[model samples]
Target: MPQTEIQILNHLPVELLSARTEDLCDILGGPTVINLGGKRPRPLVASSLLHGNEHAGFYAVQRFLQMNIGELPRSLIWFIGNVEAAKASRRRLEHQPDYNRIWTEGPRPENKMAMKLKQFIKEQRPFAAIDIHNNTGKNPHFVNVNVLEKKFLFLAHLFSEHIVYFTEPKEIFANAISEICPSVTLECGIVGDESGVDHAYQYLNAIMHLPEIYSLTETDDIHFYESVARMMVPPDTEILWEDQAPTNPNYIQLSRQIEEDNFKDVAKGSPIATFGGDGRILVMNQKSKELTDDYLSYSGNQIQLSTDSVPSMLTSDLRVIRQDCLGYLMVRRRLEI
Candidate 1:
């Protein structure tokens, strides 16, 4: 069984510097909650490794602590999630629930950890929250927010001008935290990228020292997009990446170049995939209803975009695509603020 409780620490654990992520659970014997109090009253909360395979956040945090052992600028609460999965270098085991997805109210054993974390947040009432993750595909680093408030947008702009606001896939950690304070989910590119680790470390460090984020203004160009739909492979259908063909006649064959399309505006009628036996594309809105017409159209055996739109998080990693989603369809939004 996955560890459902977290170990709390008032100071940085010096052993973390030499500890491998896999050994974290063995060290703490569970998830860990570290509070580094500083001059600032309301702490900045950062939750990392919700997906075990994404290690950039873990490394970034380690680097930050190593460099600034005794001189933190503000109160900080850090949650290290899914150390068991990190031991195996997998996103999550077959029996484990996605750590980020279990934040909603529930009594299930899997929900116990998230509930405990939520209770902690409620007691602390943090100034802001950040949940760091890494994509499985080739994509630029971006920030995702659950709300479009100025603080949220500004926080995201600090990392990248590419800001995505997603309301679906509810129960995400950032979404739950955003209800109380400004929160952003940072997608720090792929794992093992030194640049990603540096980017997150710098951003987190900057935010930790900030006296107030609500008064901040964006000096750089910022583009806002809303996630409109989630693309998923149909159940029981085989998936073939790139030029690979499927033996099953009803399988869907997505282009190997799918990841290449991330953040680019795909033109209408652009081919996204080819399916056997005249199967239609399966795209669903946040409501889980078939919204294929909103994003894609069927052309003979090929599925193409029905309208011009940008897609993010598209991945060639078949396992990730199956476990999470193919990607999300996005549309640019002009905010009055």
Candidate 2:
């Protein structure tokens, strides 16, 4: 479709994104980007829709742009990632393109969208990039910060005195985007929920006014380093894996020792967590276990660990690992990064 200048509100669904880029330069001819030329450059880019069904964040982004275009930082840019998937409301390109997974290996040399975003980011080199997303569940409050160690501490200082990080360096969904810019993902909760929309709006408001955010700064860099050091969990702690499939519930647990003295016949409904070649965690839940009569009669119930259950190994004698967010607690541990 030919891109044109977007009014944002009425035309949001029609690709204001393509418009932004087209307006900036006729390089590709559609709608280009609108560069905010100012004495001091702004370093923020807010983007969304890496996942297809995650539409609330994208909508919120459009709404935010509408209300605060003038107050927006001079160098800030708004983007819609995975435009194809978002358009179809699916996870990725029909069956071949996985927008979230594309970052795993970096943009394909010839892939148009990936190459375009990569080139744009490289040219701008913003200080921070905030990507919005929807969690798999109904809870709208979860947020994930998957930053390179060098950028972790920078986030801590910029965002809050308390910012959480994944214990290990797993292949993250946003790795490709973050590799070029400081980044954060706001899980705006489950879509279809008005509260989720509200959560996204409030978050956008806070980020827009955040004092710490600007073109990259030394102070921001220091926090990034500290975040890297602070979020690494120690080895030896076992975290039970929860599957993300639609049929499964997400929760982390301590793996039960199969060789322990207390080991008995497998329970009929108990879950078994295993791994594949690259250590990809696989969770077999009670429903499947019961079908196979694995062992005891255990029902799958979703539960978060009590605050007291946070691994003690993280105390005075152990290394300080990342903590959970306000009103949330650390539930399970992940293996070494």
Candidate 3:
């Protein structure tokens, strides 16, 4: 099991922001939780670096603390996670569990740490919770929530006009915290983009001073989607990149610019991928049941959409695609806000 011991501190070490990730680990130790207290009774919680390669959250939080300097408008609890992977500049080591996935319930050390965090939430009763992340694909900044409550949408819209609600891949930090307080996951573009860092920092600053998170009176302008299914490459299948077709029959040749389709509405019969031989693509809902022709189907060798939908988190990175999934399929949700 990976090291799950958490460190709790009451003060912010400003210099650590300027230091390298590995250096930050050396200074702060591991998975440190800090409480920057203010006059407010309940704190706002921000978590970052669940995936080590995604650095926007870390940098944004760092910059936010730097700008505030002294007392904040409200108390805040910051959870800095996956310092080991951050130090190595990868997502997570092969042996380690995904930090975000272990938050629900389990026996693993990471899950234990997650339970501890939940305890803290129960005790402190935070006003809101934010988990900052950076996507590996070309997509707009969006917020993800597990529940469609007014306060959740309000908090999500405060970060971005695009919002996604999903219940799959359970045990994520956002889902767990949403039960206690209005919580949302902010996807701030990709790693190392200064623009993403700036956007997240600004959003955090704005939320810090808010008296309360309430449902919006008018939300017609907001784009809401419900993630219903995940698209995946078969475990035994090999993915072929570039324009060249694969010699192996089990390979799937995805579009070279597959990730570019992210966040765009797909019309019915749009091609998503093509196979080398008789190999088929896999589409499964949150329950892990294979979707039939209602969602997607194969025409000759090409995989095409059978319904109008939107996909998110499509990535060209082969490793990420293989380890996680191709992306997620979403449908427009009409809600009264």
Candidate 1 lDDT, 1-337, residue by residue in tens: 2487667888877888777787887777778888888777789998888988888888888887787777677788989998988888888878888888898888776577787777888789798899999987888999898887888877778889888888887889999888888899999998888789999999988988888786337544777788899898876778886478678777788877788899998888999988887444578987789888777877788888988889888888888777778888899887546
Which portions of model 1 miss their true places by more than 4 Å? 216-220
lDDT of 2 by residue, 203-262 (tens): 666665555544433432221111111112212323342333222233223233321211
Q: Specify the highest-lDDT model's number.
A: 3
Per-residue lDDT over 1-337 for candidate 3, one digit per residue giving the tens place of the 0 to 100 score: 2357888888888666586665656777678888889767689999988988889888888888778777888899999899888888887888889998898779888899989988987788899999999987888999998887889988999999898988877789999998899999999998887899999999998888888887777787899899888888887787887586677778788888988888899999998988766666788887889885678888887879999999998898888788878888889888765
TM-score, prediction 2: 0.51
Q: Tell me the whole-model lDDT of each prediction, alpha carbons only.
A: 0.83, 0.42, 0.85
Instruction: Kindly report which residue stretches of model 2 are placed more than 4 angstroms away from their true locations once superposed.
Output: 1-40, 104-112, 148-164, 167-173, 214-281, 284-337
Per-model clash counts, in order, read 1, 29, 0
Model 3 residue 238 distance off true place after TM-score fit, in angstroms: 3.3
CA displacement after TM-score superposition, residue 337 of candidate 2 (Å): 17
Query: For model 1, what is the C-alpha lDDT against the true structure?
Result: 0.83
